[model samples]
Structures are given as structure tokens and as C-alpha cells.
Target: MTRCDWAENANELMTRYHDYEWGVPTTDERETFELMTLEMMQAGLSWQTVLNKRANFKVAFADFDVTKVARFDDNDVVRLLNDAGIIRNRLKIKDTIHNARQLGKWHAAGKTMNAYLWAFVDGQPIVNRYLSMVEVPAQTPLSQQISKALKKAGFKFVGPTIVQSWLEALGILDDHLATCTVNHLSK
Candidate 1:
């Protein structure tokens, strides 16, 4: 079977995420929150690592429920550190809760996460036809703009690299390989 150019490994998890979730536009506030949190957990780590621990991350993160995660306390942080299924980094774990709180703040400001996020692309995906894996970019001006806005909103772990990946995953940007079917399909 074929896949997106970025998929160097066609393992089960990668394949599933690529086929079903990657590059698919998601407007759900909860999902955007989850992706943001996961991207933070992925810092100094591999996407595959996060994917392998995804189930555990979901459980530890309370199924990516924004309200519940935003309310997590110090005790909750300790509980997460002891959990074997997810990454144990204290800062990254704490950032998850921090991001959730920011999400709530955005909502209170009358801007849903989905709306605020998708607005950077003007409610359309930035489709790129990369001929090879190396041809795809790590960051774009749009991602930079969003990253700046996210930081201003008091969100942590939203650097340019993470923001760019998040946008691609959320389908705000499509970096599918030009030869890949989805590249032409999305256009």
C-alpha cells in the first residue's frame, strides 16, 4: 500500500493515523486541544513515541477533555509522572494543563479553538505539492503567525515547529507528496 511521502515507516500506528486522521480538517475544539497537547508531549521526542503512547496519553489527559485537563492540579501531575503509559516529563505534562487553560481563555474571548486556529489559513487548507519528503517545509509564514498568536495567548509548547506540524495534522495545511494520491485528491 502507498501513503503520504512523510510516512517513511508504514507501521500500523502510522498507517492508521495517516489514512484516517492526518491531513483531515478538524474543527472540534477538543480535538485541537488534544493535538496541541500531544505536540507538546512530543517535544524532544519522536512522533512515533507519542503515537505508541497515545492510548495512555488519552487516559492520562482525561480523553483530551479541555475542562477536566484545565483543572488538573499538582497531585494530578504527580499521578501522571507515575503513569508508565505516557511520557514522564514534568514540564511537558504541566504544559498540557496550561494549554487547556489557554484554550478556555480563547473560548471566553469568543474565539473557539477551531475558529481561531483555522482563521490563520482563512478557513482553507494551504495545499502544498511536495515532490519528496525533503521538499516539504518545516515552517511557513502562516505557521509563524499562528505560533506568535498562540504564544501571546499564554499557551506554552507552541513553537514554530510544533505549530507547523499541528497545522498540517489539523488539515490547515496539506503537505502531501506531489506523487501521492491525496495531494491531487485534496486539490
Candidate 2:
């Protein structure tokens, strides 16, 4: 029943995420966008805090549907700002809308969101063998490259650290500890 140590202290919300979602590879564009949005919202805050408010986020942001969110306007911004169920940070909330627009632009430009996201790692998930959370990195050079590229592509709120988490969330980077039963690359 062993898991990544971080998940040990995770509440039911996090435990479920770790067990079912974390580290699982995903290629769906909408799902990828959702993960990136959630990870972006997680910046400067805890995953649990975001997880606790995930439902609110989903509801507020059109269930993480990038297309619908991309259409959000000033009125949507005002509404989100006044909501207590989710983080009311104006910049982050506004950025979600901007990020969705960027996602649409990418799609319009013939870019496969999934392929573009996976290209950083050459269409493969990175398998790590950390023994503990301390050995895990907050960011890597590849993550930095991806962040820079994504920012260049017009995405907001995506820094190296945030991109790193996004990569993990997309399962493009498998950081599960060697001791974790869910470790995908354990020997």
C-alpha cells in the first residue's frame, strides 16, 4: 500500500488524485488543457488547496473546457473575482482565460496540443528513480525550455516550476518515487 510520501499525508481528495490521476499519461487536448490550467492555478499555492476547490474551479471555468473558457469575457472575470469557492486572484483567474485563448490559437495554427506538449520530452515520459520527495526536483532544464517555449507561444502563468508540475500532471514526466507502488518505471 506504499505510495509517494507526499501522498501519504494527502487528504482524500489528493489521495484519489495520486492513486488514479497523477503520473498517468494523457494525450487528450481538453484534458491536457485542464491539467495545465489546474497546475497554473496551483502556483504560489498548495496542490491540496487547489484540489479542495477543484470542483469550484471546474464549474467556474466551464468544467475546464478550454473552448468555453476561451470565450470568457470581462463579465466572467468579474464573476470569478467575486466567487469565494475558488482562489479569487485576479491575475490567475484572468490568465486562465488568456491561456485558453492561446490554446485555441495553437490549435488554429496546426499545432497538435498533445504533440506540442509531449515534444519537449520527445514523445516519451521521463522515468525517474528518486528514493524520496527530497530527491525530486522542483524544476529541470527541460521544464525551463518548455516554459520558455510555452510563454513564447503566448501562454501566461507558466513558469519553469509550474511547467514542471504540468509536465508531471500530463505524465510526460514520471516522478513517482522508486519506493512507490505506483512507480511506473521501477526496476
Candidate 3:
């Protein structure tokens, strides 16, 4: 079976993530929010770490339910910090909960995160051709704009780098390699 071309260092977990989830269009608000939180938590950490504990994160964060996560309190923070299932970082855990609350506000304002986020690209994915992994950029002007907007919208942990990663993961930015088996949109 053919698979998406990935870096040689990618292990089974990363390979699976790249094949199944990377550059896939997603419109679900909950899924988008979940990935946003996960990516934020992945700031200094590797994507593999986030993927490995994704199930645990879902359980701990109430399946990424915006309402529930937005309502997390001090006690919840403490619980998450002590939970081995997810990352034990206090700051990121707090930011995750905080960002959920802000996202809820945005939703209540009749502004869905999907709509708000997709607006950066004028409601379309930005396909990028790359010869290899090194050719892929870490941040782009589009991501910078999105990051600025997200910060203005009161989101935390959403710098340009994280926003770029989100764009790629959600198919807003397709960074598939030219020779990738799953290079359908690379052309």
C-alpha cells in the first residue's frame, strides 16, 4: 500500500498521523478546537508526544467539548496537572482551558471558529509545493495574519508557528511534497 511521503525520522505514530489526518479538510468546530488545543500543547514538544497521548487528552479534556472545557476551574487544572494521561505542563493546561472559554465567547457571538479561521485564506486552502521537508517553511505571511487575528480574538498559545501548523493540519495550507504518494494536491 502507498502512503504519504514523510521524513525518514517519522516513526509509526507520526507516519499514521501524516497519512490519516494531515492536510485533511475539517469543518467541525469541536475537532478544530481540539486540534488547536493539542497544537498549543505541542508548542515545544513533538507532535508524536501529542499523538501518543491524544486519547488521554480527549478523556481529560472532556472529549474536547468546548462547553465543558470552557467551564474547567482551578480544581480541574490541578487534576489535569496531576493526570499522567495527558501532558503535565501547568501553563499549557491552563491555556487550553482558557482558550476554550474564549472560543465559546466567539461562538456565542455568532462567529464560528471555522469561519473565523478560514477567513485568513479567503475560505480556501493554500497549496504549497515542496521538494522535501526542509523546503517547507515554519511560518508564512498567511499564518502571521491568522495569528494576529487569533490574538485579537483573545486566544492564547496561538503564535504564528502554531497557527501555521494548524493551517497545515486542517488542510488550510497543503504542504505536501512533490514526490509524496499522497501528493494529490501538490501539483
Best model per TM-score: 2
Candidate 1 accuracy as lDDT: 0.83
Better of 1 and 3 by lDDT: 3
Which structure among the candidates has the greatest lDDT?
2
List the pairs of residues colliding in candidate 3: none
lDDT of 2 by residue, 1-187 (tens): 8889989977899888887778888888888888888898888899999999989988888988877999999999999999999999999988989999988887888886799878777888888879989999999999999889888888889999998998888888888888888643321
Candidate 3 lDDT at 13 equals 75
- Candidate 1, 98: how far from true, in Å? 0.9
User: What lDDT is reached at residue 17 by model 2?
Assistant: 84
Report the lDDT tens digits of candidate 3 across residue range 37-139. Answer: 8898899988888999999999999999999999999999999999998989998999899999998888888888888778777888777778878888899
| Candidate with more favorable, higher lDDT: 2 or 3 | 2
TM-score, candidate number 3: 0.92
Please report the TM-score between candidate 1 and the true structure: 0.93
Angstrom error of the Cα, residue 128, model 1: value is 0.6
Every model's TM-score: 0.93, 0.94, 0.92
After superposition, the stretches of candidate 3 with alpha carbons farther than 4 Å from their true spots are 1-9, 183-187
Q: Estimate every model's Cα lDDT from 0 to 1.
A: 0.83, 0.86, 0.84
- lDDT score of residue 44 within candidate 2: 86
